[model samples]
Target: MTEKNKTTNNGTSRRDFLKSASMAAAGFMIVPRHVLGGRGFIAPSDMLNVAGIGAGGKGQSDIAAFAKSGKANIAYLCDVDDRRAAASRASFPKAKYIKDWRDLLEKEHKNFDAVSVSTPDHNHAIIAYHAMQLGKHVYVQKPLTHDIWEARLLTEAAKKFKVVTQMGNQGASNDGTRLMAEWYDADLIGDVHTVYCWTNRPVWPQGIQWPTNKSEVPKELDWDLWQGTAPRKEYVDKLVPFNWRGWWDYGTGALGDMGCHLVEAPFRVLGIQYVKDVQASVGSVYVDEFKKGVFPESCPPSSHITLTFPKTNKTKGDVTLHWMDGGIQPERPDELGPSEPWGGEEGNGTLFIGTKGKMFASTYSDAATLLPKERTKDAKAPQKYKRVPGGANGHYAQWVEACIAGYGKMEVSSPFEVAGPLTEALLMANLAVRGHDLKGGALKYTWDNKAMKVTNFDAVNKYVKREYPAGFELKA
Candidate 1:
């Protein structure tokens, strides 16, 4: 038995303490707050104990947000690299530090109420799936999974396990998304038929050959553990601390990195689900005067992909979403003044084109505005949905509260049910981007959502479900 389930000197286990605390008001007289502890004290049982996996970079901020919620206690921290995990370990000095996530989950599952997965895109699904199987609530970072099959599996797992799940696309809980939905519902933009979501990502290296020389593994890092689900590879510099997004082996390119944030607005506003078909055009890289670089392992420096979704209850016809990365963007709408920012002050944004008008929002779906710029001034829509307490910042707390309330009690903004479809849509777009690199791959690829395959291109179908290394295989 685990330490948490062991009997205490008073003949009560921690489980028993929790059960009794839950039954306190029903089974016995309630004591006043002042008599119990003090004016603003919270019982230990009321707190959600969270175990953090990948405790560095985005992982660090994710757990810090949960702790900021005041109802969540950072119970454990796990990371493969000590250097990357230094700050988080210092911040949560009391949290049990573990080097391997598998060890933490296998040995300490009973100690925490939930798990936060902030690892690379390739490992997101496996970690989250395992945690869900163990009956733990999970909050995973964006692009939920590297492949479409994994997203679908996790979506079904959440339903089967009946656990509260949330994706780390905090923008789903932002007021801008809700406001955009309100405008769409109000018919302010009529029926949206097209959306353009663009980003200036791949800020990392892309369209390049893999490093020919391997570097010595850093003493503070566990190279093997870091390559968890990926096939074994020699240690290389600049892949860690954030350049992985450019490689197919460990990252999902710009589409996977920023698609969740930019496309989420349209998904929430238009009620879009799985994609119907996709096609793409990508910029080429030439190695020399006569030779064109064909690096299959790396993502293209730039690409423009188009995804089509069948008509939903919210729309009159099919919807077309254009995804552009590496600084590509759509043509400027005539409705906007020359001085007005196309997608906000930033170069990245999502634009919705409806029969009546056009609307757009910047990254994180912030600064939502109607085209013609002036239309935004007179736009008014009835508040139809309840706003999250702190908007985008409330995302972490929202999951914490819902987990404490138990599954199906409270709602989270980016639950797996919704995130699954959104993520699959982006991954589908990636199929087209990757296909662009193959022979006769530039043509449109028809998608069979039910089968989760590309009906037109057999070569691209292999990417729908990636093969894992031994001991890391994902079971259906």
Candidate 2:
């Protein structure tokens, strides 16, 4: 069992809590809201008191969604940058505010029943793990963690802690994923041996050297807290709010930003669990006519990655999933008409190429349609899966209600069990992306998922489990 579940803040192990709660439940009948109040119903007195870390930007929207549910009371807000957090502070006037998440979780953990972490990729696992250790239900934004080791650890931690957990890949709750699954189960697409997911991301700056001129850290922002697990470095111009997605230290690049949304459907439809190997080719930037640029700190402007997943029940053989980013896209299928839109105008989508036919969907699994226009127009399949009410938008309330309902009593669309491996797949793919920066000519990185290392390139394995800064270790 994980240390988190072995002993909680209340001095009661999850096993103890279960034994006692079960005994209590035997004598006292606890009625679920769906039975006593009704679906989408919550008693005001039983509202879930939520604490949000990184409560700004996407975090702001996440917390707001919980508030909109009316069953979640935003009890506390935390963010390193006051400038970015201003909107959320004003939105939740009654929420007590703190800048450091460690302080928030340490001092105010009991004040809130659950925690929402929407921070950068680097610090996600640490904060989320601590919250779970406190026996608090957790809602973490996607890509789950910065490294493959962290992803595997968090996945195991969630099950061991016996805590209700959810990854903020809202698309997991989308009807589109279910619809695609229904079609696939009906053999509409037959066995999907190949899949393609692409996105026009890194809309931010990438594939460049770090700014030589370091900028002054904003007075309103606590740069140290923002850097969390990342090594201390001088703050640069405009790194806050969003551009961090392009950096290797703080973000997971385009794949981290859109992979969960774009790759989730294929995972669900094909039952992909773990990736076996990965290889990538990245777009390079020209610093000048005389020299090729090499910036190890930033993600490339674009990349095309290939991941091989072992055979699953849904596939006749192994599956090869292609991931492209930075405006790179796959060739239009012949079945698609000349004028038909490819992967949608949003410049992000997933296409499943199977033995019998092909299916495509936009990011977040929306706008799913069978290819060959005529086939989509003529196809019909039985609904074999239950659709999440409100689809992607329901992801927030689903967590809120589940938190209030207690662990194991409620179901979430993107629980750690599913999101964990999906995230590992993305991170493993990233291992190849980062590996491209190696001095060697080229190599296909065979992944030993069990060992959490790239078997072919020992040098690149350093990125699989990064060294944490002092006081920021990830515990099992």
For residues 1-476, could you state the per-residue lDDT of candidate 1 as single tens digits?
Answer: 35875433322323432233223313333232234553243443487888999899999999999999999989899998999889999999989999867667666665677899999898898888877777788999998999999999999999987889999999889999999999999999999999999999878999999998989889998776677678777879989979988999899999888899999999999999999999998877999999889898999999999889999999999999999999998999999767766785667899999999999999999999998888998999999988999999999999999988889999999999999999999998888888866774667999999999989889999999999764466775
Evaluate model 1: give its lDDT: 0.86
| RMSD for each of the candidates | 7.5, 6.9
What tens digits encode model 2's per-residue C-alpha lDDT throughout 444-474?
Answer: 8898878888887899889888997645656
TM-score of each: 0.91, 0.90
Cα lDDT for residue 248, model 2?
93
Which residue pairs show collisions in model 1?
A: none
- For residue 278, model 2's alpha carbon misses the true position, in angstroms, by 0.7
Query: Clashes per prediction?
Result: 0, 0
